[model samples]
Target: MGFLIGQTYRKMVGILAARFKEYDITTEQFSVLCRLAEQDGISQKEIAARTVKDQPTTARILDCLIRKGLVHKEMSAADRRSFLVYLTPLGRERLDVLLPLEKATLAEIFAGLDAEELARFRETHLQLHRQLDALHQQQEA
Candidate 1:
């Protein structure tokens, strides 16, 4: 089951990467961008938490985005220690381009599935995610 799910995720990522070649962004980077798009001005630590990424890895990704001029980080006014991350205009423009690629990829990936099957698949996926989350929390405890 793990192999099957991993292969499916890998293939989907491969397809999206190929489709968005001009962006020079990996799926991980795109994920960070999408998270920031939904919750802009969030702290790097918060981004890490929300993305289920470690602080160092998230920081490294944010550094690359900063270098690319796609994201900006500012010292948090409320927390003297933390920094807030937000997407720049360039990042938003890139998202505008990437969103269509994502939608088209989903359309292609689910081309044959009927609505009922798709709904069931989505529910099952969510259940799997929740179970995984619980497992992780147990390990942490």
Candidate 2:
């Protein structure tokens, strides 16, 4: 069981790590940028919820992105306590470059699988994720 779990996690991490390295960004940071790109002007708290990261960890990652001029944070006009985050021009450009590589990486990973296998794999993956989410909710409860 342990071996199976380790292999599954390692393969997922290895692929992401290699692609992240190619783009000179860590996996966590890329996730933040992708989230911001999709949901621009979202609050940091919302980003943390979406990313399943703690607030402090998300804050630190955002700080690095801000320093690199990839993201800008502005005080939310409607909410004095919250700040809205959006990608800077540089961030959008960088993400544009990285997205192609991400697509290529995903293609490479799925290349050898036949259509039926691919469908089955996705179905199983989604099922597993649902089960995991249920477990997480149970634990939280």
Candidate 3:
């Protein structure tokens, strides 16, 4: 089951990555963009937390996005050492273009499942995620 789950996750990401190829971004990068779209001007640490990525991984993604002119970083007023990340105007415009494409891609991917089945699938994944999160927290403690 774990293997199948991992396989399916990769397949899904692959499909999305292909769709995003012309935009010169990966699904991981898009995830960061989506996070910034929801809330801008947040610290890199906060972005990493919201995106469920480690600091270094998040920084690397930010670096790529920064290079692509999709996002920008500025020194935080409260902390000179830390930087706040924001979506540039180009970033927002790109995100706007991609949002509907993303929705369409997801709809096509889930076309086989009915609404109820999709709900159950989501619920099950949420349960598993919560369980894993709790286990991780326990390990950390």
Candidate 4:
């Protein structure tokens, strides 16, 4: 089951990467962009947490996005050491274009599953996530 899940994750990333190729963005970058779109001017730490990426990995992704002129960072007034991240206009425009592509890709991928099945699948995943979170907390404790 873990193997199948890993395989499915890789395949989904590949599909999304192919779709995002024209925009010169990776699946990881798109994920970060989506988060920024939802809440702009957020600290990198917040973005990292929301995206489930480590600070170093998130910094690297932000570097790529910054290079592409899709994202910019400003030093936070509250914490000069940390920076607040925001999407450039270009980034927002790109996201607008990519959002539909993402939705369409998901729709295509889940086409076989009816509404009820999809709901069940989502619930199952949520339950798994909760279980994992509990395990993680236990480990921390």
> Each model's TM-score, in the order given?
0.95, 0.87, 0.96, 0.97
**What overall lDDT goes with each candidate model?**
0.93, 0.89, 0.95, 0.96
Off-target runs (Cα >4 Å) in candidate 2 are 1-6
Which 10 residues in a row give candidate 4 its minimum summed lDDT? 74-83
- Write the residue-wise lDDT of candidate 3 on 1-141 in tens digits: 999999998999889899999999889899999999999999989999998999999999999999999999999999999999999999999999899989999999999999999999999999999999999999999
Of candidates 2 and 1, the better by lDDT:
1
Ranking by lDDT: 4, 3, 1, 2
Model 3 pairs whose backbones collide = none
Off by over 4 Å in 4: none
What digit string (tens of lDDT, one per residue) describes model 1 on residues 1-141?
899999998999999988877888888889999999999999998899888899999999999999989999999999999899999999999999998889989999999999999999999999988999999999999
Clash list (residue pairs), candidate 1 = none
Off by over 4 Å in 3: none
Candidate 4, 1-141: lDDT as tens digits? 989989999998899899999999999999999999999999988999999999999999999999999999999999989889999999999999999999999999999999999999999999998999899899999
TM-score of candidate 3 against the unseen true structure: 0.96
Weakest 10 consecutive residues of candidate 1 by summed lDDT: 19-28
Candidate no. 1 TM-score: 0.95
Q: Write the per-residue lDDT of candidate 2 for residues 1-141, one digit (tens) a residue.
A: 658968976886689778778667877888899999888999999999999899999999999999989999999999999999999999999899887877888888789999999999899879887998999999999
The lowest-lDDT stretch of 10 consecutive residues in candidate 2 is 17-26
